[model samples]
Every structure is written in structure tokens, then in C-alpha cells.
Target chain A: MNKDYLNSDIKFNKEVFKTPENYFDNVKEQIYAKTIENKDGQMQSRVALWTIVKPQLSLVASFAIIFFIALFVIDKTKEITPILGTADTSSYIYTIEEGFLKTNFIDFIDPSDSSNYREEIPQDQLAEYIKDNIDIITIALLD
Target chain B: MTDRDIIDGLMNNGNRDHLFRLIVDKFSERLYWHVRKMVVYHEDANDILQNTFIKAWRSLDSFRGESGLYTWLYRIATNESLTFLKRDKIKTFFSFTDSYKNVEDRLNADPYFSGDETQKLLYKAILSLPPKQRAVFKMRYFDDMKYEEISEVLNTSVGALKASYHHAYQKIQKIIEDSV
Candidate 1:
């Protein structure tokens, strides 16, 4: 409608317009400066912090564990299995005799292992002794 | 050259007066209108437009070719304009009456801003809207911006903008019907 509102019906207070030309010039200078800093040939390198802490602790811990484990693995590989049940070995008989006296035959066995009683009693001997020494059980009971 | 070529030349540190001027010539009036609708003042629009260019020029180094250059520039200008609005709102809230007084002054001075008797009812309906919804409405209708572009600028969903616009139109329609 040509019956629209009047120009006098509104007012726009104009703000001051100042050229900020200096700002652009300053920013360009700063960018150029930063670019120059990037190009400087100082072979700029930062000391690797994680590289030191990570690998060094890992090496120490790993090797310490490995040293213990190498000794373990090598010791394990060289292990004799104590010749316990071998035909020429008398250790099974020694263990049975020791068990008869209730003394540990493998007393000098690895103390670092969790348990103190390290000797493995012969199953067959144990069964036989259990059958034959029913009186030993009764004595233990009476006592 | 076009804005794209100008931006390219500027980023490469080559001659860019033609490009910059092309931008100023092609977009300045449209951008002026967009800014004017939000701020409702020619002066604030001028400040926002100048600041927008300065930012675009400075950040041209890190422009990264992510979106169209003008779209990126528009993003900055929109943020600048909204931030200005927020700051002005804080200043206006010192006396609540003063805020409406400012609006009253604008309605008295500008002719392109006229809404009829129905439009008066509509303005009241719109003024009652939350600031974000009001902004979405202004951008969608006054500036004729695409929902996708508005979404990029507002970091809102297109669905949300559409809903806000639909709600705004419905509310205006309802208010006008009531006036009759």
C-alpha cells in the first residue's frame, strides 16, 4: 500500500565510522613476523618428555622382570626335574623315607617359592603307606 | 574477479584490491540489510561489516578452505552481530523501560520497518518470543536465508530452525486472525 508508514515514523542513530586501517597493517606485520620465526634454522627440537619416562621406566621394569624371568626361564630350561621318578634316581625313595619320619626331604628347595613344603610325596607310596600304617593313624588318634 | 578469486589472491598474498572491492560491491548491500534487520540500525551494521572484513582479512591465513570463503566470512559476521546484540541487551537492561524506548524510537523513524495494524499485533506476538526464536525468525524471514546456512551460522539443527520458523509464522497468523 502507498499508505505505508512515514520516514518520520523511525529514527536510526548513526554510529561514528572510523577507519581501522592500522589494525590490518599491524596484523599483517605480525603474521609476517610469525612466518619468519617459523623459518629460522635453529633446528628447533623439544626434548621428548614421554620418550624418556616411558621407555626408561619400561626398560628398567621390563628388564628387571626379564632378568628375574631370564634367570627363571634359563633356570627353567636347565631344570633337571630333580630326576624324581627316573630309574637311577633315589630321590623318590628319599622322599618316601623322609615322609615316613615326617621330615621334608626337599627342605633346601626354593624358599622363594610360596610354600615351605616343596616335596611332592609319591602317590603310590603314599597310598601304600596309608594302607599299611593304619596303626600309625590309630597311634596319632590315641595320642 | 569474484569473491572466490579475491579470497584466493588475498590468502596467497597477491594483489587483491579488485577482489576485496568486488566483495564490498556485491555483498555489502545484502549484508547491510541482514545486519540492519537484526540490529535495526545502519551504524551498527556498518561497524559489523567493517569488523567482519578485518577478521576475514586477518584469518585468511588459516582459512583452511573448509567451507566457501564467503560462508566462512558470513559465519564470523553473524557471530559478531549476535555478540553485539547480547552486549547491547546488557546495556539496555540497566533500565527495562529504556529497552522498549529504543525500539519505540526505531519504529518512529524507519519506514521500511512498517507493519500494518495486523503487523503491529504481529510485532507484539513476535516480541513475546524468546530471543533465540526471535533471531531465527528474523534471519529466516527478513534475510531470506536458507535453513542450511542458518544452521551453519547458529550451530542449530535445520529441523530446529524450521520448527522455530513454523512456530513463529503460526503465532503471527494466529495473532493477526485474533486482531480481526
Candidate 2:
């Protein structure tokens, strides 16, 4: 028969492991005392709670940072981007084109047609028009 | 006192400290031995056992009673032992010049260890096994722990644990044979 290596007859059993006299009792007292100390101080519990919460807190923090960065990038984009959604571009285009035509369309008109378009205005009415629109004309010129 | 009583005592806010004492009284020695066999030193085992209970006490609220209290505590003790073993292995790796001879010498020098030469050799062979495998073998062979319960404690499949124990057994047998 193969030697029963794990049998107690080998004297290599659990009995070979021993502790000091009153070790168990003393250890119990030590554990109880330490736990009681923990209860009174509550520091160990707090530290344990910190260890458990630390990783989750880091994850939350990382998300918060990403969220803020996304928010900041979005805000920057909004600052540089034009407004979106149902803007009445036809009216805006007409107004812009009207201004452009008023300033520069004379160049595109035929010289013969331009002579016909030259209706004389009364000096007094022209003066009134200039007075009424002087601020806009001055601002446009400045721009 | 029954584990139920202990659980009930821990659950009740009125007498948690008293119940914790019961817990200490109940599981300390078993946890100590479970740790002691792995580390093979009483002081290290004592420290690990204390940390295990202290950890248990701190996490009592998370215990859902899914497993028996002993199993839960055994799991904690096993994890603590493994962690200690890993840290000790790293600390000693650079300085561990003589390997198994150091283990035998350490065992021989331990005042609490009263084993004969054969027992020392057995322990030396055992300690030579990798830490986790040593734990598997000790749990099964010495503590008579069931593979299922060890699976729960180790969070390993029972098949893997059986294989690990078999391999550990073969290795220890070989080491002892060679040494003899």
C-alpha cells in the first residue's frame, strides 16, 4: 500500500499547530477590545467606508470632469456658431440685398437707363432725408 | 449560541456590540486556524484573524445572509490570508536566497511549532507550493473543507479547485519524496 501521507499516523496532523496557553481567550479579548475601541472611535468604520467609496467617488469625479469639459466645449461652439432653427432668412436676405443694391447696384445699371433714373430731388427734401438718416449713414460709414 | 442568534443580535441596533462579542467568541479560533495553516506563523495568523473580524464587523451591514456565517467568515479569512501571502512573497522575493531551506528553518524555529522532523518536512513541502495552491490543498486536506464550500469561499469553480488540489498534492508528494 502507498504510504498514507496525510494520515495522523504521520504525526503531521493539525495537532502539530499550537498556540500559547490562553491564546484563544486572549485573542478573543483582544478582538472584542479592538472592536469596542472601533465602536467608540468609529474611525475604522469611516476608513472602511472611505475605501469602499473611494473608487466610486473617483468614477463620479471623472464623469463630472468629462461632463464639464463637454459643457465647456459646447458653450465655446455656441459662442462661435450662428443661431439654428426656423430663422426667416428670406427677409434677412432681402434686407441685406436691398442695402447692397442701394450702395453698389448703380454700377450694374445701363448708362442709358441710369440717365432716366436720375430724378431730381428738391434740395430741402434731400436735406430732410439726410438729417433723418444721418446717424445710420454715419454708423455704416464707420463700420 | 447559534449563528442565527448571532445574526439576529448583529441585526438588532440595541445590542450590536454584545452580538459582535458573540461573533468574536464564535468565529475567531476557526478563522485563526484557517489563517494559521496558510501563513504557518501564529503572529501573522493572529494579525490576519483580527483584520478579518474587524473587516467583518465593518461590513456587517452588507451581509445578506446568502451564505452561512461561517462560510462568509471563512471567505474573508481566506482572502486576508491570500493578500498577506502575496505581500509577503513580494517583500521576500528579492531577499529569499535559500528558498525551501528558509521555510524549514523558519518552521523549526517557531516556538509554537512542535512538529517532528517529518512534520517539518511536510510543512516545508507544503509551503513550497504557490500561495493559492497551498491554500486550496490546506483547506481540502487539513480543514476537510468541501469543494463546494471552498468554491464559495474562493469564488473559484469546484472543478478548478479540484484540479488545483490534485496538482498541489502531487507537487508536495514529489517534494517530500525528493527531500527524504
By lDDT, who's the top model here? 2
Instruction: Write model 2 residue lDDT over B110-166, tens digit each, in one string.
Output: 998888888888888888888889999988988788999788778899999999999
Candidate 1 lDDT over residue span B1-180, tens digit each: 665676677677775444554555566555655665565555566567666666555555677666776677677777877876665655455334555556656655555454544444445555545556767877776567899978988999999999998887666556545555
TM-score of chain A of 1: 0.25
TM-score (0 to 1) for chain B of model 2: 0.94
Best by TM-score: 2
Top of the candidates by DockQ: 2
Which pairs of residues have clashing backbones in candidate 1?
A9-B108, A9-B109, A10-B108, A10-B109, A10-B110, A11-B109
Give the alpha-carbon lDDT of every model.
0.59, 0.77
Off by over 4 Å in 2: A1-4, A7-12, A40-143
Per-residue alpha-carbon lDDT of candidate 1 for residues A1-143, written as tens digits (9 for 90 to 100): 22222122222222211223463344333433333233331321323445435656676798899799889887876655655346344655676767753443234457577773524656676676668778977898999
Clashes of 1: 6
